[model samples]
Target: MDHPSPPRKAPTLCSLRTGLALLLHFCNVALLSQRVCLSLTMVAMVNRSEPRGAPNASLAAPLDNVKNPVYNWSPQTQGIILSAIMYGMPLIHIPMGYLAGICPVKKVVGSALLLSSLLSLCTPLAAEAGESLVIACRFFQGLSQGTVQVAQHMVWIKWAPPLERNRLTSVSLSGTLLGPSVALLVTGFVSQSLGWPMVFYIFGAGGCALSLLWFVLFYDDPEEHPCISLHEKDLLRSSLAEQVSSGGKSVPVTAMLTSLPVWAISLSGFAFSWTNTIAFLYMPTFISSKLHIEMRENGLLSALPHLLSWVLSILAGHAADFFLARKILRLVTIRKLFTTLGLLPPALLAVSVLHPSVSPLSSVVGLTLASATAGFCMAGLMINPLDIAPRYYGFLKGVTVLIAMVGGLISSTLTGIMLNQDPDSWFKIFLLMAAINVTSILFYLIFAKADVQDWAKEWQGTRL
Candidate 1:
């Protein structure tokens, strides 16, 4: 009698690779968070109650004194300094995939962070020199980190299996939220007591340290890791047999950029990022100027929304994996639904937050809920790159991140022009953000899908 073999057991998630990936992501996010704080901290130190009817407060700089030397860059100069990072960010994404393809992903990601950390260490010295140096250093910081996303995707391509993809990607990316939260909470105290320069020095030190740790522990291929057990490695190889190829040619650039799936993911990511950069760049200022909160207190208050956002993102990732694993819904349906759940409610709630009649406490609550719910997109658009093209995930990530960086540039610069120090005018900015979020979700619903595209494997026999 012929008997069917028993079904293979699903692999466990308690692998060393998962932990290493998570930690690398967490540390990189922390580096990003610290750079974000420099601008907000400067705003606090330089503005110094000027909006409380002080003369030319927006353009004033403190005279040389005991605290770290000051630069009185104008509002226009400050705007340029903040946007400098995004200017360099968008230019590097397209090239990053090629770098990741040629080099070990850990080398690419770790080296980039090391450079960013070194740049962060030099920021105070550059700032004291003049505005131009500050802008130049900030731009290069963004340049160094631009490759991080693409490199991480390259690592995930060789590491994650289908059943574990959602949880793995979301957990790794949760640093997007945690980075800013930690930055806001800690930077305030570090700068307040130790001086503003320590903010960069303390944060940059971790990035430099982690790059060396990453080199020691991480390997680009499952077969290459010194620490992985034989059984787990075999499972990984077997799981990846069809999805990835060891002798693959470069990703087809025209095929990638022209693909509908890529554009859908990229466009939606633009909207998601537009809303997010608002929180990163402006939330502290809003909390401080509007609610009568001080800078350190404002950092704490600003951090609350991000902390809740982080928790919700993790829960959302787990729930997404659960739904997909049980086959309770189609993967495509689940992704679109998650997008709606994340972007729609946040947009609807954000409008109410801007109402003049709302009290500061009520406004804070409203913003928190909106931000927390926005975390669901982490499980949706963010992970779709690996879903559609495991072999070329790095390239796809570059495309999407580059698209989103354009939105970051626009939102950051526009907010600077729109808010000259007045809290009352901020409601209009919130509404504009809500409208963009709503529109982006609508477009995503029409085009987004979760299945691996046929073109994903089309490069197998083609010329390089």
Candidate 2:
């Protein structure tokens, strides 16, 4: 009787607790797996939508007297036309982010794709119409492009879990880099073989294809995914429920803006974006003008740096996750570390301009290294929004992007002014960028921290 009465109450209690823990862990794993599968599929679909065409071809065609009827425009004009998208991005991204916050992500993304594709298809028509029409089309293309970028970020926030977020984000964002690579390579070939208009036509067709795929496959949340398995759906609901129970509500817009860390990240983003825009929007021109390279050569050379950066970005993303898993660095520290390291090279390379004897190839190589280093910053700044506030990541991202667009606008205008004034002292413009990069790094080091601010958590509770 005594033996029966004592029958392992401790063991039973331990067994129950163990079972619950196992169940919870399994739920998290299952939910994460489902999210990963869905995210990968969506990212692949989104990646397909990026504009890629012959880089060399796109550049060379406008210079060719026979193929390019509008060859009368100067290189600066061509650069402006090509870069009109970056110039208009900041103007549109803020509203686009808010729109994503309110609307269905799938519809918003798909609609943007459809509109962008339609506009891309019409780009050739604009060329035939007139320069003003072409400029107008470029502006429209920029608006649509900005919307697509914001929508994709929003979709990732909604669909991806915390653990998988960085890699998934990297994969999604790699489209920006990859799109240019493919465009440079393919467009180079297509523009050379077929014509400049064919580049837009091909990208348009691809965009339309991706729009259809997105409509078919994407859902706003796991609860709504028709193809999700019952077990998987249950797991997702359970995991999300736990997060909802534990985490505070979405942080209010006003409170988020008031936070120091938010501005720190925003400032870092501004510098990072300006550097990226300079490289992406102006590198071709730099190679052509400074290096005395022909347009075709510039396109091929410009593509190399981006291709290098794309690879580096993927690696940096994975490396960041690995470092986080080891607890070697907090999220904020990791961002700062990578961002500081990445930013330094560009600043140094800009100063390399002091030595004018450097060969064009050497200059390209220096610029490429600078760009590749900047790619690592994406691991920090690009993925930090998820680290800070998963619930309002889309909105925060919108804010950061809006801030960053100021840099983009500055880059475009400054480049124009510098070129108009004395294109040779482009090194001075680089020096200005270097100062911005250094200042941003210092700001982030001082203000950015991984811990959720007490004010932020309290505000989230009240707001939600």
Candidate maximizing TM-score: 1
**After superposition, which runs of candidate 2 have C-alpha atoms over 4 Å from their true positions?**
1-66, 74-80, 229-235, 242-251, 458-464
lDDT of 2 by residue, 1-464 (tens): 12122111123123322222222222222211211111111111111222433322222233552443332343345545655666656777777766677788778877767777777778767665655676677677667666766766765444444444555556556556655555555555555566556667777777777777667777778777776566545544554553421122444767788888889888988898778777766666566566766444555776777678767776787777666756666777788887787787888886685476987667778888887787787687777766676556666777888898788767766776677567686778788899999999889889886665555344454343
Q: Backbone clashes per model, in order?
A: 0, 7
Q: State residue 301's C-alpha deviation in candidate 2, in Å.
A: 1.2
The TM-scores, one per candidate, come to: 0.91, 0.80
Considering only N, C-alpha and C atoms within 3 Å, which residue pairs clash in candidate 2? 52-183, 53-183, 53-187, 54-186, 54-187, 54-188, 55-188
| True-structure RMSD for candidate 1 | 3.8
**Highest lDDT model number:** 1
| Reference-based TM-score, model 1 | 0.91
> Taking the tens digit of each residue's C-alpha lDDT, what string does model 1 give over 211-296?
78878888888898888888778777887777764234766677777788788888778877777777777777677777878778
Q: After superposition, how far is residue 200 of candidate 1 from its true place, in Å?
A: 0.8
